[model samples]
Target: MDIFEDKVILVTGANRGIGRALVKALLNHGVRKIYATCRDLNTMPSLDDDRITVLSLDITNDEQITTVAVLAQDTEILINNAGVINAGNILEGDLEGMDNDMSVNYFGTIKMMRAFAPILKKNNPSKIINIVSIAAYSPLPSIAGYAASKAALFSATQSVRIELAKEGIAVYAINPGAIDTDMNKGSDWDMPDPESTAVKILEYVADGKFDIVPDEMGQGMYNAWREDPAKLSKIFSDLYYGEISE
Candidate 1:
């Protein structure tokens, strides 16, 4: 079945980056309506389509989430793609930076889930898709707080999946390696295109896959978990530190 055909969908952070791409892809898949929520709806690139409804939303704001949840009551798919990355190591960074990262990435996601879980439960066969990162599995020093937030989100995704399974709602966690987005504008590593990543994610979602690793790096990390966890962890540590250790 083409899950997106005639489906009503909601994608947070739909102004730019992966979220924007996902909104376009969902439209291409025959989605009947899409609520594209961002901090400022006017900033969203012009879609010039009647099916796309631009909404102003700040995921961290409970009132905004509640308002939108009621407005998008027919939504069958919720894409939690809004996130923030604070660049700093755990030791050197101020507590505020760490808290900001957690507030937006982890708590914000949880808040959205809490607000929409009931709506989703009422609309049976709905699904919730969370955009996590490979950093969740392998933390890096430079983005320790960002990684920690995502790690917490990954754990929450697992718990949500288990708890919601009985309610007939499927929860998915999509962990992607570096993707070419404003979030990593100055990074010096190869990153996949946001559009490509979005397309791949939608494909997996259509197949009802619960967990999606959207790139080679993501698959490698998952494979290493089974083959050699310690070695993989050291490899990631060395990559971030520039030297191998005993």
Candidate 2:
């Protein structure tokens, strides 16, 4: 069965980057409807399809998340794709930026999941896709706080997967290495195309993979970590800008 062929999907951060790509992918798959959300509705580009509904949602805000849950009652797939990136070391980062990373990347997703889990359960055989990152497995001290937030999300994803499986809600966590987006500029590693990454994501979702290493780099990172995590951690911490990263 094609999981997305007739489903109602609600995507957070649908305005740009991977979220926008996913919207287009769903359209191509002939989904019934898509409730596309961004913090500011004005930022979302208009789509010509009648099946698309735009909504204003800041996942960190309780009222907004509740309103979305009420409004999008028929949603079958919840894509927790919205996130924030904070720059600085964990020891002495800007408090607001660090807080924002956790709030948006970790807590914000928690809010969305809490509000929508029941709706998805009611919809039975539904799915929840959380867009985590390769950073979830390791640390980049340059953006230490952001990595920590994703790491927290990764843990939550695992627990959600096991708990929700009894109810037929398949939870998917995507860990993509470096995607070419405004959020991922100036990276030391090769950044894969966002559209390609998005396509790979949906393919994995259809294939029913719970934890996905979405791109080649991500797969390599996963394999390397599995082989010897200590070696990879030291590589990231000591020589992130050296030959191995490239």
Clash count per candidate: 0, 0
TM-score of 1: 0.95
lDDT of 1 by residue, 1-246 (tens): 388889888999999999999998888888899999999867899998899988899999989988999899888889999998887877887678899999989999999999889988988789999999988887877788999999999999999999999998999999998899999898777888899899999888878788898877678877786587775687677777773241
Q: For every model shown, what is its TM-score relative to the native structure?
A: 0.95, 0.95
Residues 1-246 of candidate 2: C-alpha lDDT, one tens digit per residue: 377988999999999889999998889897999999999988899899999999999999999999999999999999999998988877777888989999999999989999999999999889999999988988777788899999999999999999898998999999988788879777665778888889999998888788998899888878878999875587577744563366
Superposition-based RMSD of candidate 1 using all C-alpha atoms, in angstroms: 2.3
CA-only RMSD, every prediction: 2.3, 2.3
